[model samples]
Target: MCLISFFSLIFFSFFLLVMGISYLFNDFVLFIEWEVISLNSLSVVMTFLFDWMSLIFMSFVLLISSLVIFYSREYMLGDININRFILLVLMFVLSMMLLIISPNLISILLGWDGLGLVSYCLVVYFQNTKSYSAGMLTALSNRIGDVALLLAITWMLNYGSWNYIFYLEAMKFDYEMELIGGLVVLAGMTKSAQIPFSSWLPAAMAAPTPVSALVHSSTLVTAGVYLLIRFHVLLVDTFIGQLMLLVSGLTMFMAGLGANFEFDLKKIIALSTLSQLGLMMSILSMGYWKLAFFHLLTHALFKALLFMCAGAIIHNMNNSQDIRTMGGLSFQMPLTVSCLNVANLALCGMPFLAGFYSKDLILEVVSLSYLNMFSFFLYFFSTGLTVCYSFRLVYYSITGDLNCSSLHVLNDEGWIMLKGMLGLLFMSIIGGSMLNWLIFSTPNMVCLPFYLKLLTLSVCLLGGFMGYLVSDVSLYFFNISYVNYNMSSFFGSMWFMPFISTYGVIFYPLSLGMSMTKSFDQGWSEYFGGQMLYYSLKKYSLFNQIVQNNSLKIYLLMFVLWIIILLWLVFIM
Candidate 1:
């Protein structure tokens, strides 16, 4: 069944590629709608919009997923639930396809919910404590987006239709539309792991690496960016767009810093994914939707290949993920090392590689744009940090002395895994140029000064130097561990975001609830109801016992005294 699905996706990818090319030239759309409900002038319909964008994105999703699945055949060879894994991958791909094609908010929810649920399942596929916690974080973070989409859908009820494609243009000028726009941007932030929601992406590395290759690298994380690109018409010139621009810039810088500080191989790659997501969000927020989408496609190819390379190395090393413990495998696993180098170079945006075509163009465009000082610094800083982390990763994992014990045998002999990686390797090599040509027939014009033109290259060189210095010499000899403990720990732990998101968000509220329960419900209720009642009853019973013994004797004596007292009272009156 897995084999059938794999080959079918490959064939379908080619078919969609052809269709996408045809649609690019002819500019035709295929729309299909089926009414599901109608009442009092309100109706709901399942709507699919097939255009070049959907076709192209769906093709890439399917292609990457198919390759990941094939790779998993070897990567997950000894697992007991391989079939379940394959099914989850297929379902994830299907959800992504549904997300790509949907034009109506209602139908888009189907795909959106599918992705959240399927990804949660895949994240917890390992059933360990780490996977469980990561899955909870992943699901809960994405649930915020789900709720936002639900609110946005409810708001669309005012327009009498859930077809967001039709409403985007007409609603842009409407003040009420900002509500939906803001909600949509919020949704995108959570899905893309922007700002407060950023911690989940790295934590989700507890899943199997094949799942990471698909979910983090391409389909799942990019869903948010793709949705924003689709909604760009409504977001242009809005406050929400401006807010997104600021938030995304911060996210890009934060993730790049986190990646540089990270030592785990998969977490580093995951942080890189977060950084690229921020780049996509930042570009889209700046109204360069096409450029964002272009980078999205190209980043997907190389990042998937990068994860696969990481997976191959991890498999060879008996599942060790710490880059600190890995070194000098370039000779032992030549093919895997070569793929890793190519992917890393592509990630660094080296000329003519997959990332260069989109990343360089994005930097040039940003440099030419009239951005704020903070955004400007973020753009360049994040760009340099990308190089820094790529060099850092290479220095630790590829070029250093071998750090493993003598007994462990490591080799790049997984033929099936290599086959899967080779497919994406080819695409990562050519995807950038191909996407650039197809997406931008006429290149964007940027009138930057000479210094700005060379800024990217210059910063890249500085980043490389800094990366090597930090990873090799500074890590060992720089006695700043005590001096810069707080600063180093802050960046190393992703600005304390995971702690803030998990414990900070939950702790106070939970403590308040516990206090309330103890003070009001348990403490007060027990005192008033049980203890007070019991004490009052016991006092009454003791008084009754005393009265019973003294009653007869006191009555006889009191009769004569009452008569005397009555006589005395009458005389006084």
Candidate 2:
């Protein structure tokens, strides 16, 4: 019950941090707590693992968490337990705060695991079946990542130096470091939902709009990308770094494949986030560390805004999330609809949006990565896929035949959420000009002209317009009763979602059946054919059964016989 508020938490964390920064700026041996783990704190105040990087990360953490808390007050005004919510928010922010400054392996793991575990609570805090499963799935996926990171730390200590700073420093050029680097990338892959890890993000749509806003859309999932940002120098020199590029490229395409077909309000955003993260990973693969972090910085702004706006829609529409059920709300709830659409257009990377600033820079970095020719293709293709899904999301959710009988003219959202969201949205629209292109983008790289970028938008726009023509054609062909979705029935999620509902549904049982069959075959083979001689030993002698099954006795006798022969050979021969 005794919990520090986010404001107080920020004040304390920052107070320690500012002192550390001042110490470092003054050319002193300044230190700060870079890691705290397993109830063990060096507790030396701000003199453990301090650095400018940690300081920068601290600043963004304060800003984002403050914004989320601000948004939470309005979004959850009448929440039955606002205090508990605030407590969770503080813990979430604190854990991240600890993570950014963690100086040791154990401390990093503490924050990493805590961040993942707390996220599940946030995702499922609403106590609904959908969000519960979604949170569980995300948590489980994160557990896989946690195991990899833990193993990596253990392996690093087993093989090299046990110290955290040493391993981090050694990894920069150690030829033997790829083993841990690969494991860390694997951990990143699962957390960021690259390729196979992509499904959990879409499933996480079961979360409340605000939780989704904070977790999947904003800061939580980006933790993986942030890890990449932290490890860029080490990874770029290893084979695993190249693997990151491929993984990022494939995830970008995968998101487009998933989101283009998804019509759910949150799922589209979820998939779009995945796709955008792929963009960040792709940039990180090229070793644009600061640019990747900047992309992450701006992405948090726009993604959080979109998720909050989506929350407003869900709260108003009696929790209906299907985009097809939300057409033309601009006429009824103009402010909310406009906010959501702006978020959508921003995600689509329309000019002037926060997404535009970040995405253009990411693509530009990819272009300038003199790493090789293939990298250019990967960047170009990733950009094309990015635009594809972004446009699809914007058009489908706002310009369709939306008729949800459950919907009411709900304007329940309070000032805190609106203020937080508007501040972010305004930045999403105009943050591009304020950014440093040279830091992230390639030096003197040729980018698409304004007309060409516009042309790309027009092509995507035409595709979006076609989507309008084809939205919910099922209404014309069949009754709602006939189209009633039985997600739990034989064909789950319409036999889509390649892994969970489709492959797992069929292949998991098939795998069990195959195992049973293998067991049966082994038993039969031993009894009748492969071991028939054992069963019918000695032509039906009474002692045969006992001898057949008694390997210990048989081996003992053989050993004695062999010893006798050896003694005989020495003595007689």
Candidate 3:
């Protein structure tokens, strides 16, 4: 029954595409509107609509969602409440449908937050300590970023109409849109897990394989990229957008390091997601917005397939996540083994794979254009690192000795999951072959790189091969902490140290302290309220009592306190 509903969803989305396309290419303006309308309304959403960019985003989101739902039936099946899972799965798709189809920023936020909410529910559906904690981390980190976005919206709303295009038009940086845009970039960075909020992504491995496969690998992380692309006009200031590029590039480097060392199967994919999104931001920052979306499209295919394959391995092994614990199932699961190897190679940008076309395109754009010297070097290094880790992920999972003395994964998930990803595998293996026709041959106002094409190809191929050849050696090196001690030297781009440390010092201590302050805060909360000097906060649970469901009284009191502080600060200024 779940299988039937899932296929029905896919067929219905395709039916929507055919119906809309049958009449869309009528007139130029009509064609534009129809493109947006078809994508947003793919799930039968009548009120949802946008322009060409949104259409591109919507089409991929719909495709990934449908594929994940189809996989869920066989991937999880009897182990879960199939009916509820399917319903929630539909809710996930519906939320994304609402998010990308809407033409207004307000509608976009509703859709964005809704996507985050449903994803949390899905990630933590098992209600285990790990999943629950991961969900909470995701929620908390994203909510803080969401607040920044809300602040941007409020700032923008103080100026003009409540339409997305109004803000998008204003993105050209009129009189006051720059500050608001800068704020939006901050929110976008956090939502996209550029760096500070990126930790939650790896922890999200607690989610079932398909959810991790779809949300992190494709839809959710891409939301930030979409936001940046949507608001590119206001990004004229390098000083402002510079932050976006620096953060994204460095995050890719950081996460790729962890990927280089990580032993957990799912975390490897999580790290790849970080770098992939980082590359997306890199492209978007350089004004190649369409290419970023195009990269996103191809990434969704291969990454989803990769994660689903990892899930199949986990299910087969009865929930073993450590790659070191398994080996030599290739004979038993040759199809899966073959698929996994191709996905890894594609992920590392091997020839003709999905990643090759998209990844190489971004590289071409960066190297041939005004992409900064620092970004250029970091970009190449990061891709090399990506290939190394991609090799490790495949190596550790398939070639080692089996340690399944107590493990119990399903023999095979059969076709429900396999069918969902077969297309992705094929695409990852052959996507680059069509790049000349689909991408390279396109006529655009922007100039194409015509000279030194061979140098460009050499850089990409060399970076990838260097990564693959010594992955085993890199693995051993990472284990010895040689790299961690000299991380700053290796990455060498600390452009935001002053600001990141000023406000974001919490990450360092938290990463090392293991919630030391959390324990301290819990221990001191009673004393804080019990003291007569503490007239503001009530004496109760610090997080829950004061934060989650705080009353109108508390809000107003906090407002007054803020006003008083503002008055004092004004006098000092």
Tens-digit lDDT string for candidate 3 (1-573): 665765676676565544433333331112123223344535222244544445445555666677777788777777658778777777777777776666556667787898789878988988888778678777767887688778877877676544555466645646567777777788788778887677777767788787888787667777777777777766545566777788788888887766766668888888888888998887788777778877877787788888988888877877778887777667556778788888887777776777877777677667678667788778887887787677666666666556567644435447777777786677666655543344444543434556545544565566556555545555565533354556633332223332353235435645656665555554465456455335444444464566668588888988999999999999999
* lDDT comparing candidate 2 with the true structure: 0.66
Where does the lowest 10-residue lDDT sum fall in candidate 3? 27-36
RMSD of each: 6.0, 10.0, 12.8
Q: How many clashing pairs per prediction, in order?
A: 0, 17, 8
Q: Which portions of model 1 show Cα errors greater than 4 Å?
A: 37-43, 479-483, 504-573
**lDDT per prediction?**
0.89, 0.66, 0.70
Cα misplacement distance, residue 217 of candidate 1 (Å):
1.8
lDDT (10s digit) by residue, model 2, range 245-335: 8878777766755565666878777877887888788778867777777677677767877888887777678777777667666665677
Better of 2 and 3 by TM-score: 3
TM-scores of all predicted structures: 0.88, 0.73, 0.77
Whichever of 1 and 2 has more lDDT, that candidate is 1
User: Candidate 1, residue 425: CA error in Å?
Assistant: 0.9
- The global Cα lDDT (0 to 1) of model 1 is 0.89
| Backbone collision tally, model 3 | 8
Q: Of the candidates numbered 2 and 3, which has the greater lDDT value?
A: 3
Candidate structures ordered by TM-score, highest first: 1, 3, 2
